[model samples]
Target chain A: MWKWLHPYADPERAYQLAGKLLPWFSILALGLILTGTIWGLMFAPTDYQQGDSYRIIFIHVPAASMSMAAYMGMAISAFIGLVWQIKAADWAAASIAPIGAVITFIALFTGATWGKPMWGTWWVWDARLTSELVLLFLYLGVISLYASFEDKVLAARAAGILAIVGVINIPIIKYSVEWWSSLHQPSTIKITEESAMPTEMLIPLLINIFGFGMMIGALTLVRFRAEVLARNGMRPWVRKLAQEQGAA
Target chain B: MQFESISDFFNMGGYAFYVWLAYGVTFSSLAVLVFQSVKQKNKVLKQIAQKLAREERLKQNRSNNESKT
Candidate 1:
């Protein structure tokens, strides 16, 4: 299994791969986000109860969903690095932390903005809100842990352990609304049941979700490539690449 | 289309402050993140290039001294 995965474990190869994919991710993310924001903000019918206040969903839902998804991505990368001692995996985990934290912050900020009008308060100690706050702290913890070490490889290992331990919060965040009495409403989109939102509203929400996903991918790739170069700066191939870049 | 006029759209049916604030914060934050990441990548590449160039200059000087000797 390790043999099959050997090629991608090379930082140079991973850097090349990320470079090739970055343009596509950036373009698609821009296009989808533009389309979704226009449609959701302008064309989607006002909610019967919330009116245009609900328009914020275009940003809030996508940001909220991506916050959790980014954590999962980081955790998975951390797990791989820990188990296989793969340098690329560690780089990926490190690159993902700040992006995840940014998204989480956006979620919390937007959640508060949305809550003010809907719940008549900016925040509550609701299960969903509290758990999401914890998720943000966990992201910060991973980042600080990684930076604490003089040796990056050692830092990555320590951060990887913390990220893995923090996996317990992911499920708690996802299920908090269902398990506890909370001011935060249940998810508008569901995996099994037909969505309560009508098609017009649902479509743009889905578009924004995909758009945000692509944006995250593009950002992560850029950061990951930088990490790869920085970590491998002393390697012959990286030096050669840098010389080529200088010439160009 | 949902609103009656430009003003109505901007007003966002009396929820303009909250709605715009949410979108404003989210998009601005995302833009900053993307901008910072791109800038960081370029900075790292430039630093690496400078290091390689310095190494090349040192190697050339060493070879020149060796030949002269």
Candidate 2:
């Protein structure tokens, strides 16, 4: 029953699996984003007040949301790998951190750009924004800690510990906008809302959100595969597998 | 579609710079992510190849010693 699942825990098996997943994710991400971007920028109705300035929401909201979401994923993977000694999970945690950090910066930067005219400033220490700032620090800490160790295994373990300990703050970041004074807007893009937003805006926004999620998942797998190969640096199978990918 | 003309659309209600800038930054970052992933995959493959060659040489040296003995 679980035999199929067990194969994936092996790094070699996981590498093969990543290959299969890569195309599906890449295609979906590429397609969805292409559609969402064109629709968002051109087709979506302009905001009554902000007009086209509101278009940034397509990218901003998705990346901002994914930054938090991806961190949660990294922390959870780190915690599991640390506690259970799941090596693949730790490699994944280490691999995805940098991508997550970059997206977080993108989100913050884009948000700032959007906010400057709307909020009259380039930056703010708002609750969600501050917590997100802290999120970026966590990502950097993980990357730096992993690189600090000369031993790759030890690096993964140390980074895993850091990520696990840092886990307590994710929810704090998510709820910060609700909890404190912030220029950041509350969750207007919630799924739980009964009838808050009109359908016209919500559809395109949701499409973009899912598009970004697919993009993140695909990118994470790509990076994790690299981490696996790098950690298994001297393994014969890794070389063989890579050659196979090159040929295929 | 809402714009009266191409120039009007670019203006984006007097917030064109910020609007275009935000979208531009987002697109560029995503492009970078895709580029880096490809680069990382290629680098790892090369590293693995080098490691495999080194291991083969070490094994060959060990076997030669055994045969002479």
Candidate 3:
């Protein structure tokens, strides 16, 4: 089943593949996010309660959801690196950490901006909010662990373990609102049941969600290419690439 | 359009500050990430070039010394 994925385990192939996908992801992300933002800001009907302030939800929800999704991608990469001993997977995990951290920060900041008017406060120590904050810290921890050692194999091992252990937080972040009487509202979009949001409002929000996912994918590929180059600096192909880059 | 005028849209129905602030911060941060990633790739490539150049010079020196001996 996974035989097709074997070719990408090689750094050269992985780097080239990421390069091929980057443009598509970048173009799609740009189109979808622009369309979604315009439709959301101008066309979505005002919330009966929050009014225009609810527009922040377009960015906040996407960033919040995609932040978790990026973490899942990172953890899966880390697991693959540890289990299959694939160096490309470790490079991918490293590539994903900073992007995940940035998206998580966007989520928290946008949530705070949204919270001020609706909740009458910029922040609260509610379970949902706290867990999301922990998620940011977890991403930072993985990044710092990977950077702390002189020996990269040891660093990757340590970071991989941390990332694997941090898998417990994703479910906690997802269910925190339901598990506790929290200030953060339960999810408006549901997969198994009808969403509370209307079609006009929900459509742009969903588009932005997917747009954010593509943005993460594009950014991850950019960083993954860099990681591959940095890791394989001694390889003949990398030297040839360096010479070509120098000439260009 | 939800608003009748450009000013009204800019005002964001009286949420101009918060709404624009959130969008501004989010987009700017993403822009910064893009800049940093491209810069990192360039930096790595430059380092590799420098290392290769240094190795080439060392090889030249070694050959020169061998010819002298």
Candidate 4:
């Protein structure tokens, strides 16, 4: 079963695979995000209460959710690296750290901007908000830990441990609003039950969500390819790639 | 569709500042991320290429010196 994946565990094969998939993800991200945001901002029905201020939801919700998703992906990569000792997995985790951090920042920033109008304040120390902030810090911590060590192996180990440990925060962030009374509203999009939003508004929002996921995937692949090159600089394939790149 | 005119659309029913600000910053950040990722890959490739070229030159010079000796 897992034998098929063994080939991609090689750095060169993984790099080529990422390269092949990058364009599709990028194209889908571009198309979906454009359609979603345009429909959302211009065509979606205004909220009965929040009015057009809710237009920010087109982006805010996508960024907010994808941030957590990116973290989960990072943690999984870290877990794989720790257990299987796969260098590519460690590279993938490292590649995801900065991207996840940026998405988390976007989520927090957009949430704050949205909060200013809806909640009459830029920020509050609410459970949901605070936990998300800690998520950002966890991303930063993993990044710094990865950068701190002289030995690459040790750096990966440290960062992987931190990423794995940070998994505990994901559930906390997810359930914070429910577990504690907070200014933040509960999730608008629900998996099991009917969403709070009507279909007109929810369609574009869902499209944007998938768009953000593809964007994150494309971005991660780009960074992961770079990591592969940097890590395998001395390898024959990497050197050949460098030569080809120079010639091109 | 939601607005009466282009200006009204731009206004975003009095929520333009918040809406546009969030969109502007978010999109710009995404653009920067794309730029940085491509730049990083190019930079790594350039460094590796340069290192290889330098090594090749060193090897040639060593061979030349040995032949002269």
Candidate 5:
């Protein structure tokens, strides 16, 4: 099962692969984010009830969803590292921590700003809001835990355990609105049912979601490449690559 | 164009603060993350290069002394 992934387990090979993919991810992410943001902010019609304030959904929803997605990505990498003892998986998990934390922070900050107009307050202790805050803490925990270790491998293993443990919160954050009464609106987009939003608004929202995902992917790849280089700095290939880069 | 004019667009139908703040914070945070990651990568690469160069110099010195002996 893991045979096909054997080549990428090598930090050098993964670094090269990340390098090759970075340009495409970066270009597409920038293009999509710019197009989606402008279209959503200027082109999409205002909400009948919430007026222009609903426009905040363009950024808030994507950041909120991507925050969860980023956590899942980290957890999956952590699981792989713990089970397979793959250093690249651990590095990938480590690479995602700060990015996930920042996105989560954006989600919270934007959500609060959006709430001010809609909820009549900047924040509420609702289930969704509280759980989302927990998710941010989880990301921070993984980052600090990883940083506290002298040995990279040991740190990865320890942080991987925390990430795996934190997986329980993802579902809670997703389903919080359903399980409890909350000031937060329920999901407008659902996989099992048709979307509540009209075509004009839904289109931009979907575009933003894709754009945010790509942005996260591009950033994670960049960080992962850096992690690989740092971890393998003593390797002959990395030294040679550094020499070539220096010469260039 | 959802708004009648540039000012109206910026005003966002009296919800300008909330809408702009949300987008502003989201984009700025993402921008910071990207900038910091790129800066960190450059810093790591420079450190690695410096370490490699120092090791190369030390190796050269050791070999030169061996030749002299």
Candidate 6:
């Protein structure tokens, strides 16, 4: 069933594909982030009670969402690598960890900032917050585990196992609000039905979400490409490709 | 507009500090990500160049030694 995946197994093919994908993602990320932030801060009408303070949601929500999304992306890549023994896939997965960890951190940090104003406290040991914190640890664990090994193969497998195991926390983070009465708000953007947010607020939130996703995508590709180059540095093809691309 | 005046806009109805703080931190973090990625790519390129140059020097040394003998 996965027979069509052979082309991507090659780092050279993956590199070319990554280059093709990044520019579009970068453009979209830049466009959406700027438009979303401006529209939310200025153009979109403000909350009757919260005033401009409500504008913080534009960045806060997007950062929080992408933080989780990036993790899922990495875990899936790791899982594919482990099951299929695809070395390139494993490298891509490992390459994505630091970026994902940083994104997760932004989520928690920004959440606290938003919390201080809206909830009247900088922090509360709420389920959502706690689960997000766990998510951050999971990311760090993967990075450290991957680095700890002397052999690259052992490192890949170890990190892959951690990624797959740690993914159970993602759902816990997602449902933390619904499972308990927490200070952190429930998900505003729902897929089962219409989102609860009004159109004025919703539009900017959606744009920012797409923007953050694009930015993550672009960053992941650039990082993944670097990984491919490093691993394939001794290969005959790496030099040929780099020279032809004028990178040499 | 949520505020009555420019001052109110800046003030954020008394929540300005936390609100602006969130945005400032978020934007800075994203900026750092972009900066680091560029830096990483450049560093990798430099390392690759250094490796290639060293290999060339080693190859030249081997050739010179053989010719001298």
User: Model 1, A228: alpha-carbon shift in Å?
Assistant: 0.5
DockQ (Cα-based) per candidate? 0.69, 0.57, 0.79, 0.75, 0.71, 0.51
For model 5, how does the per-residue alpha-carbon lDDT over A64-134 read when each residue is reduced to its tens digit?
Answer: 99999999999999999999899999999999999999989988998998899888999999999999999
Where in model 2 is the C-alpha error above 4 Å? A1-4, A242-248, B54-69
**Which pairs clash in model 1?**
none
lDDT of 1 at A178: 90
Ranking by TM-score: 3, 4, 5, 1, 6, 2
Specify the CAPRI tier of model 5: medium
Model 3: fraction of the reference interface contacts it also forms: 0.77
- Residue lDDT tens for model 3, A79-135: 999998999999999999999999999999999999998898999999999999999
| Candidate 6, superposed: residue stretches over 4 Å from native | A1-3, A240-248, B1-8, B66-69
What docking tier does model 6 reach?
medium
Q: Per-residue lDDT for A71-166 in model 2, tens only?
A: 888988888788777788888898789989988998888889999988899888767888888888999999999999989778888988888888
Please estimate how well model 1 matches the true structure, expressed as its whole-model Cα lDDT. Answer: 0.92
Instruction: Give the higher-TM-score candidate: 1 or 3.
Output: 3
lDDT by residue (A18-69, candidate 1, tens digit) is 9999999999999999999999999999999999999988888998899899
Best by DockQ: 3
- Of the two candidates 1 and 6, the one with more favorable DockQ, higher being better, is 1
| Model 3: per-residue Cα lDDT over B1-69, one tens digit each | 778899989998899999999999999999999999988887898899999999999999999999999
lDDT of 3: 0.94
Poorest stretch of ten by lDDT in candidate 1 chain A: A239-248
Q: Choose the strongest candidate by TM-score.
A: 3
List the TM-score for candidate 2's chain B.
0.76
> Candidate 1 iRMS, in Å?
1.6
Model 5 alpha-carbon drift over 4 Å, by segment: A246-248, B60-69
A116-232: candidate 6 lDDT, tens digit per residue: 777888788888999998988988999999889977788999999999999899889889999999998788889999998799899988999999999888898888888888777
TM-score of 4: 0.97
Question: If the candidates were sorted by their DockQ against the true structure, best first, what order would they fall in?
Answer: 3, 4, 5, 1, 2, 6
| Ten-residue stretch with the least lDDT total in model 2 chain A | A239-248
